[model samples]
Target: MLPIQPSPRRKAIAAWFQDRLAWDSVREFIAHKTVPVHSGTIWYAFGGITLFLFVIQVVTGILLLVYYRPTPSEAYESVQFIVTRVAFGWLIRSIHIWSANLLILSAFVHMISVAFLHAYRKPRELVWLSGIVLLALALGFGFSGYLLPWNTISFFATKVGTDMATFIPWMGSTVGRYLRGGDAVGGATLTRFFGFHVAVLPALTSLFLLFHLGLVQKFGISTPPWVEKRSRGAGTRPPQMPFFPDFFLHELMVWYGALALLGILAAVFPWELGQKADAFASAPAGIRPEWYFLAPFYTLKLIPGHVAGMEGEVVGLLGFGLLAFWWAALPFWGARPDGTVRSKLVTGGAVAFLAYLSTFSLLGYLR
Candidate 1:
């Protein structure tokens, strides 16, 4: 057979794509990428780990969408059908829940590691800010998703979380109403949360992720303080491993291990559909928000009825808000590439925060 000749349209289309994509440059960039080698390098995996879990969430979430109905009247029934009737629907839902939790956990670890390493110093400030933004979005995903099934716990939890907004300084009630799409956590609230969990939060997160990853690739991973000092003294940069094959394989191993763990957790504690939510019924006693929010919720519960002439809830809300702002702004503290606050001070602050959270959470559980 004679050799086929390309049509003019095909030739033009291929040329257009070639001009737009720059596939060769992308391949070259990937091939040249390197991950720094150091004793603390393994901590880097948590960032990638969080990213992988998010991918799992997106995939499993889409599958569950096939069976998930957002309406309050049908939400619980739809979830029940997925668990009991749909093929492997139970597995998919379980994976989604488990991965969501793990994704949050991984993000937390990555943030703490970055803080300790002072990775947010100097040129990478925006990377740290973007990462923090992504972390908040991940929490948003959890908060919104928890209410999707319209179960008893989720119903109460959403109510309690939304109530916090009512304590804000000026726009409290307005923001709270906007969140619920009305005044209460009813069908409107459920629908609003469903839209946020699947569409709004994901869209925001995706945009932030691209910004975050672009900066990470631009600046490269931050080397640990000790390693950097030692390398500087020795007049050389730290050794690096190729990001393409060697480092990528190690990341895959970490991901596989994480997946195995998530599978075990899901299989052992498959998500409960819980009692169908009844908005008219009183919220059950001892009801609390998800584990991530437990620390904050408990702190608010422990605050006295009033603080400094302000309503206790409002005072607590402002306090928490300030604390969050301070933590998020840590990178802008004029810290050098290697140092921010004194090491002991940072360590002590972290310890105190952990102790406070633990004590409050335990008391919350006991109470």
Candidate 2:
């Protein structure tokens, strides 16, 4: 058979795009990029999975926004209309809620994997910082979107969450007012949160996500310390695979699996709209924030009204702040001066932190 060649018209179209978009450089970068191959390589897919879920969130959120009204009077009704009236609206809403939850879960897993692999050491510090910021933004997205349905549970939960913000010492009241848009979770609070969920948070997330991805590309994937040591002892470099087809295709498969899981969950257990929020009604019993916040929520509940002459909530908030700072600064403390990881110490800290979160969150749910 004769060799096939591009038709003149197809060649012209390709040349036109090449001339205008200059995408050749991007292709060149992809062609040259490689990822380390090891047992830990599978952990890299979680980052891509988190990114996939974020894209899912943006798509579903826009679909819901077309019919959603942001005001207190209309918010619940708007959601009800979406699920009840629009075609497949119920599925879309359910997917959005489920994907939001999974996005947070995936982000946490990615962060933990990075920690365990010591991927945050040395030049990748900024990458780690950017990732931590992105995770915080993901949580922000969840918190802001939680109240958009304007249900009884969400309203009380937001009130409780905002009230908790008021224990941050000097800026507590100001931050609380800012979050609530005044004194309480009312009409203005709803509007503010809606704006944040749709606009502000997304914008910030995009910027940070771009920075994070850029750093990842610049640094390339990091092999675990033990893997590098083993490679050195063997007098051979670690094995690697092309990032384009090999890793990218595997990541796509993982995304498809995630999509399948999401569809099954959404179909089997569609998210409930619950009762319309009544600000005057006594809060329904057992009001609590979503699972992501449950650990801190339950911890706060256990604290007495006072601790060592300071408000217990204030003390708890300060403790949380310190813990967050410590975790975020892991890239510094996790490594020794000689560019080696303090493996035992870092692993112990991670285990303890995981234990605390899991134990408290489970107890919070059960109680």
Compared with the true structure, all predictions reach lDDT values of 0.87, 0.93
**Which candidate achieves the best lDDT against the true structure?**
2
Q: Which ten contiguous residues of candidate 1 have the minimum total lDDT?
A: 334-343
Candidate 1 regions exceeding 4 Å error are 1-20, 334-342
TM-score for each model: 0.91, 0.97
Backbone clash pairs for candidate 2 read none
Q: In order, what is each prediction's RMSD in angstroms?
A: 4.7, 1.4
Residue range 1-367, candidate 1, lDDT tens digits? 9999999999888779879996767779889999889888899999999999999999999999988999988999999999999998888999999999999989988988887776777788899899989999999999999999888999998988899899888999999999999988899998899989988999999999999999998988887667877899999988889998999999999999999999999898898888999988998877877677878888887789988898998988988888778778867653745644355555565567667767877777777
Q: Which candidate number has the best TM-score? A: 2
Residue 100 miss distance in model 2 (angstroms): 0.2
Q: Write the per-residue lDDT of candidate 2 for residues 1-367, one digit (tens) a residue.
A: 9999999999999899999999899899999899998988999999999999999999999999999999999999999999999999999999999999999999999999999999999989999999999999999899889999999998988898898898887898999999999998999999999999999999999999999999998889999999899999999998889999989999999999999999999999999999999999998888777899999989988999999999898889898899989999999999987789999988999999899999999999989
